[model samples]
Target: MSADVAIIGAGYTGLSTARYLAASGVEPVVIEASRIGWGASGRNGGVVSGKFRIGFAEMARRWDLETARRMHDLGIEAIDHVGETIEELGIKGADYRPTGSLRCAHNQVALDALRAEADWLTGTLGDQAISMLGPEEMKAETGSRDFPGGMLNRHGGVIHPLNYVLGMARALAGQGIRIYCETPVTRLGRTADGIELHTDRGVVRARQVVIATNGYSDLTPATDAVRRRLIPFRSAMIATELLDRPMLEHDRSYTETRRMMRWFRKAGGRLVYGGRGAFGKADSAAAFAALEKAMRRQFPQLAGVAVTHRWSGLVGMTMDSLPHLSRLDDRVTFSLGYNGTGVALASMIGRHAARMVLGQKTDAGLLTSEALRPVPFYEIREPAVRLVAGYYQFLDAIGR
Candidate 1:
């Protein structure tokens, strides 16, 4: 098989790349090791967070205030693009909610920090996208006194995750872009014409390759460079049969300012609560048990509620907690490292990648500029995530 471009992984990134490339009259084929949306794209909490873990103040200190403001604009651009896609395609059953995002602070110290960050965002950057809600307002919005305050993004919201990716695949199919599931690229070789992707079925020779594998990127000889940097940690979720509390009518997604990154939201008649899983990839009963305990601790009324379902998915965490794009060689360009906020970001990164393939100008800015350094001692760190995860939990406990 031969094509102009080949994309690995059928998640949101790969599908979006194919979508954009096809729209530009470029021939692109998508090949996935598993079915489409079999990874994080299908299994995540479905929040279009449009957020970065790093606050704007810290970002300004690291780089410059101008760069920090640009990052904010980039996030909104990503989610807006996703919103436009859903509307243009009229994706059925996506259950998209434009009700916005509420980032609750677990403790007073965190609340103080959030308030300061909100001040900088509004004052220094002159940004009006987010606002700080005090304890009283947070209590009314979240129906919980555990939160001291919250940072509200009035644009970010939630969706039916699986349906969004599947909808994109359907639209791509309509455009004659081929998606082949269970078609893993075992090895890649640079040929005279382009890169050759070898699979059990056949060799696919393409002028260019896009590695959109993200968390699912494996430690194989073909893609070990990525695995060393991609911290493939698992995050799990439990859905309650009944949302016993009064969920905020305005907020569609609720995430807490914790190192563990716990989140929950109203989904129809139920509530889907999720957080970091055990450090290992293979989930344990202890992970779900911990989730239940944490959920009850946050809302004691949920102790009697029945957990209807439980599941886990991998998130591609980077050292800097930012998405990255770079070239593997002259023929292979790749993007990854979303740090668990990939829902909207991944698709936007893919569009930038497609534009790169087309040799067109793209506004990726720092996204395409910051090529991530490979994680140090990744071979050792991969097997021993407990030490790392434990430290994060400890930081949360201390409110650092």
Candidate 2:
């Protein structure tokens, strides 16, 4: 099969890329090893916050204030874009809510930091959409007394992830975009005309190829260099049975301020909670048990609740803790390393990547202007991540 462009991986990035490409009058073929949204895109906590893995203050310290502000604005725009797309496409079953989100602090020190961040966002950066929620407000909103305070971004909310991506897939299919599930690209090579992707079912030759595999990327000689820059880590989530009363007073998504954070939200009358998993293990019964224990610790009211579903998915983490979008070559472009936050950012970056592939200027600002550097000792990332997770757990225990 041949096309103008081919996309690998049917997650948010690939599917959104195909959607945007098709809307631009370019029909692209999307190839996926599994069904759409089979990876982190489907198994996540479903919170759509207007923030990246890196905070605004840290980004400013690392880069510059203006650049940091631009990045932060881009995040908010991404969240708005998701809502607009859902409405514009008339995607059914998305369950998208613009009700906002909460970032709760586990302790007083974290609460202070959260307040300072909120001040910087609203006062210094002129982002009036984010506000500070005190302990009483936090308790009222989340029905959890464990948090001292929190930060609320009115632009963010939650969605039904699987439904959203599936809707995108159906929309693209109706637009005449070819979607091949259960098809894995074994080899990627450059041709005189463009690029060639060797898949199990057949070969796809296209003038442009998009590598959107993210954490589930297959490392071959052609992509090994790019893969070395990403560290794939597993995140596990569990959903509890329907509750008689709503857990939170208000319907909103919530996450902690810990180094290894825990995120939760109410969906379909059930509470879905998720966090970082055992570094080396993909999914385990013990991990789910641990997650349940953590969830109960935060909301003791649900101590005896039955878990209805437990699943884990791999997320690509960059060393610098930022997402990267760049063209690997003249014919190959890629976007990955969302650093455990992909739902909003990935959809925005995917469209940006599509624009890049079409030889159009994208307002990626400072993010896509540079190449991703390789992570040191990339082969030993598993062990290193395990050690880091252990250290973060210790810090969280001490309220640091």
The C-alpha TM-scores of every prediction are 0.96, 0.96
Q: Locate the minimum summed-lDDT window of 10 residues in model 1.
A: 219-228
lDDT of each: 0.84, 0.85
Q: Report the alpha-carbon TM-score of model 2 versus the true structure.
A: 0.96
* lDDT for 239 (candidate 1): 90
Which has the greatest lDDT?
A: 2
Q: Lowest-lDDT window of 10 residues in candidate 2? A: 217-226
Clashes of each: 0, 0
Give the Å shift of residue 200 in candidate 1: 1.4
Off by over 4 Å in 2: 219-222
lDDT of 1 by residue, 187-232 (tens): 9998788899888899998999998899889834566767777788
Residues 58-129 of candidate 2 have per-residue lDDT tens digits of 788888998888898888888988888788778899988888988899999998998889988888789888
